[model samples]
Target: MATAWFPLWLTLKVALLATLGSGVVGILLALLIARSRLWLRDGLDGVIMLPMVLPPTVLGYYLIVVVGRNGMLGRWLYERFGVSLIFTWQGAVLAASIVSLPLIYKAARAAFEEVDPSLENAARLLGSGEAAVFLRVTLPLALRGIGAGLMLSFARAMGEFGATLMIAGNLPGRTQTLSIAIYDAVQAGDDHRAGLLSLLMSAVCITLLFLSGRLLRARHRA
Candidate 1:
């Protein structure tokens, strides 16, 4: 039924957006970590990677407390700009991004690290600016890894449930992403709907996994 699949559709939409946004942020963070000679690089590296070490549910709860309209950052946003995030699609995306950030960070960091430092140094010696060297030399060599990171991040975001539910709630047309929809169907004893959503999510996740694997293998060949 249309009603049954509505939640599934909403979830997929939110997850897709979250994946893109998170992928971009993660790659940027990875690049910063990779290239940084800053005084606190070690400390900053730990901070960026800390989310992966924390429990996801706890992180989600923290997100709600920070980004929810009634929460600190959320309240500030509302007071300053009349913006709200709690119980919305954007909130779901934020939750998913936070939950899956580790995947992107790890993938991109590894990719960036794999580039030979000498190539970048040579470009710099040849009078290329730092930005120019990164764009023309480092990024090209790391493109395959970046692609793999994107696929991994996308798959992880697609499976995000706890954090997204906590921040976004389970509003059918607004925040009922595929994972939450499946959970709701099971709770309501609607095995049929539950099974369908499960299969759909599974298929999507599998496809992403396959793509990531392929990209990683190709990188190995290169």
Candidate 2:
């Protein structure tokens, strides 16, 4: 039987987009929180990490409340812009991005915190602006950690099923992802397809984890 490659392609596409989106947002938020006062930082950090600890179904429900057809934001978008995220590929991306954010944020924040303050201070003394200092000094030093975070987030996004299914529904060739496809295959008694997809997903996740470990080791060596 010819393997259905669409789920794999869709999974990669969603994971890639989610990783990019979460990476940018996560880094910025991590930096901001790291520099914030204790109270504000704690509050924001807890809020940002809520999705990580919450049950996936619970998070998906909240997402639905916020973006479902009759939902607050969803209603406005649908009426004004004719945009419907629910039951769409974009919704899957959104779900994946949300769930992957905490991994990126935590890793990036830890990396940022480990950066030498003296280096930043020296750059400032040398007339480097905040942006310049971050670009030239801080970011470079933390690149490895950030890269690891991106990979981890990609892995998480690729495996996201509950939230994506809740919002995007399992529409083959549209919103059905690898994880979803695997589940569908099993339900339909297509064990062979499910096993193949499961193996592929495992391989991808393991490869990402291996790369992340290498990046961490390299950072330590540096």
Candidate 3:
């Protein structure tokens, strides 16, 4: 029974951590892309959004090439810090983060852009620094929309499959997340396990979707 529940626990942990890390980075990137006058804004947004449209297998392959033990960052980490991301739960978190990033990015960017620039300029005229202006005017105004995106990111991470499978290798009790567990159970003809896992995933995802929608509607009303 404990074994039956392990994947769920692992999936929750991976999704939570992934969402936290990715949501912050995504929101920050969205801010940059939405407000910066830099020429690279469009290019950065395109690269960030690619994960949303690319085949999961293609993304997985890219992850492998960039993070595998022989890969650049992987090699540096292993040699410098004796750390390896391969086949670990941390690797799964990284995969989930990458796959789910676009959700948060899009949501955050839209939210930030919707905030009236006049309000920010008003703060600036009142002697607020850039950071102060963002914190007091832009961020508070955009919080609800960013929250919607974060919830979506959590759901997407909880259901991550191909990239996680590639980087984390479906190691039960170690890195096998709920989605991978369901796949493994189905492949092994364990319908009962698969059914339970599916139910769990469905319930959580539905809840997140519902909450995200409410937040978006509320944001618009504001």
Candidate 4:
């Protein structure tokens, strides 16, 4: 019990950070995709969402090749910065971010797309630049959608397992996050602990979904 607290808290912190980072990137990318006029928008949109549809193991394998110590970018990082992502907490965050990115992107894109283009145009006519209009007129009105996206992304990150396991491995007090911990408990025949962890994970995910739905519904009414 005592040994579990810090690791669980650290896992939550990693998930929170990954969710925020991915939410920001996802929202920005979604906005750009929604505003694009070229046919390339469709292509880019598909590519951005590809991770959501792909197998987690496959994604982890590729990430390993790109960021693992023996991989290209990984080798460079180790040589220069003495940094390595493989089997590290940061690598777990990276895996979570990639896996949860689509949730935020889809929500934010829908929100952005629902906004009237004329509103942006009107803001432009009033001397507001594109960035200003997005920050003020667009994002403010879409807060609820963005909130839903963030919540969902955070939930996804919290539950992420396969990819995180593949890339970060199961190193307790280091890289073993909640999901991995649960797996370890179950596999080691510690059914009692596994049951507790499962209950906790389920409660968290359900709460996030419930709250997100409420926010989305409120936004719809507004």
Q: Which candidate should be chosen as best, given lDDT against the real structure? A: 2
Show how many residue pairs clash in every candidate, following the order shown: 1, 0, 0, 0
Which clashing pairs does model 3 show?
none
**For residues 1-222, what per-residue lDDT tens digits would candidate 4 score against the true structure?**
665665578678879989988988999899888888977998998988988999999999999999898999999999999999998999999999999999999999998888888998999999998789989899887787788788878988988898999999999889998889999999999998888877777777787778778877877888
TM-score, one value per model: 0.88, 0.93, 0.92, 0.91
Which digits, one per residue and each the tens of the lDDT, describe model 2 over residues 34-147?
Answer: 877766778889999998999998999999999999899999999999999999999999999999999999999998999999999999999999999999999999888888
* lDDT of each residue in 1-222, candidate 1, tens digit only: 677567656766776887788788889988888878888988877877776787777888899788777889999999999888888888888887877777888888898999999998999999999889989999888888788767767777777888777778888877888888889889999999899888887787787678778877877787
In model 1, which regions exceed 4 Å deviation?
Answer: 125-127, 211-222
lDDT of the structure predicted as candidate 4: 0.88
Each model's lDDT: 0.81, 0.92, 0.90, 0.88
Candidate 3 Cα misplacement greater than 4 A, ranges: 210-222
Tell me the lDDT of model 4 at 216.
79
Instruction: Give a tens-digit lDDT track for model 3, residues 134-201.
Output: 88999999998888888889988998999899888989889999899999999999999889889888
In Å, residue 9's CA in model 4 sits off its true spot by 1.0
Worst 10 residues of 3 by lDDT: 1-10
